[model samples]
Target chain A: DAGVTQSPTHLIKTRGQQVTLRCSPISGHKSVSWYQQVLGQGPQFIFQYYEKEERGRGNFPDRFSARQFPNYSSELNVNALLLGDSALYLCASSSDSSGNTIYFGEGSWLTVV
Target chain B: AQSVTQPDIHITVSEGASLELRCNYSYGATPYLFWYVQSPGQGLQLLLKYFSGDTLVQGIKGFEAEFKRSQSSFNLRKPSVHWSDAAEYFCAVYAPWGGYNKLIFGAGTRLAVHP
Candidate 1:
């Protein structure tokens, strides 16, 4: 089975612009979570969606938002992007709400210039 | 607040040598712990996890971790290192509080395997 998959493997945007990153969870997976990994640092949680509902959110700013589709796919939207937002945006998917063992995608590398 | 700490930012070990990576966590309740490995430009892969069973839990790829409640630590170890083991390892904690599952990740420790 294919693991979690992300789109736009690499993206470049200017400050104040908006960007949307997409993720398709593994077949039969119901939970999807987003994370941001800055250079030299581990991934920091951004948002998590389970059964098309927002389950949890991290310390990210309000400009960052996400939603899950009826099919369990997810999109992370970032508005008013900043230079600091240049990082690897990761999408992880799991089978349940427990969020214990998640499968991650290669991640979308977003660069805010 | 729940947090994870990986003391060593980078570690180098020769192939066939034993390997150990330390992880420490701070949480009020019994936190769900995990260790993930990430290859260059790849996504993170679950190496193993410790929930509520034996202190020593075995995981994929011949990896194991020991959870010590007294020290608030979960350290990953392998009997013999392989060249393929050269990757970034992250320690994470899952706190199930208020019906929300949030993961706290450490800065990660990069393992360098020298042949």
Candidate 2:
């Protein structure tokens, strides 16, 4: 079975630019969550979508948003990006709503210069 | 607020030696705990988890973790370490309350295996 897959493994953009990262969850998984991992830090929760609805959100500003499609795929969008936005964007998926045993994707590395 | 803490920022151990990584969590109630390992440029992989029942949980790649409720700690242990085991380890916790409960992760501990 294919694991969680993310698109544009690495991306670079200038400040004030917008970026959209894509993620496809594992087969048969319904929950997709986004996380941000800066250098020398652990992953921090961003947004979570399940059944095409926003389930939870982290402390991120309104500039960050995400959505899930009917196919269980997810996209994370960041607007007015700042240099601090440069970090590894990780996507995780779980089979149920319990949030147990989440599987992660290789992550999309976003670099804002 | 819920939080997870990994006391050690980095740990270095010789190959074939034993390994232990500490994790502590702060929450109002019983929380679901987990350990994940991330190799360089790779996604985080589930090492083990603790929900309820037995305190000892076994995970993939010969890894195990024990959950101590009193100490609010879940520490990962391996009988012997391999060079390939060198990676960043994360400790995370999930609350059981309603709504979209997200996992709170620690700062992570980097492991270096020396041959």
Isolated chain B TM-score per model? 0.96, 0.96
DockQ in order: 0.75, 0.77
What is the docking quality class of candidate 1? medium
State the lDDT at B110 in candidate 1.
99
In TM-score terms, candidate 1 sits at: 0.96
What digit string (tens of lDDT, one per residue) describes model 1 on residues B1-112? Answer: 7889999999999999999999999999788899999898877898988889799999999999999999999999999999999999999998874568867799999999
Chain A alone, TM-score per model: 0.98, 0.98
Relative to the true structure, how large is the alpha-carbon lDDT of every model? 0.93, 0.93
lDDT score of residue B29 within candidate 2 = 84
Candidate 2 chain B has its poorest 10 consecutive residues by lDDT at B94-103
**Candidate 1 backbone overlaps, count:** 0
Candidate with the greatest DockQ versus the true structure: 2
Which pairs of residues have clashing backbones in candidate 2?
none
Give the per-residue Cα lDDT of candidate 1 at B29: 76
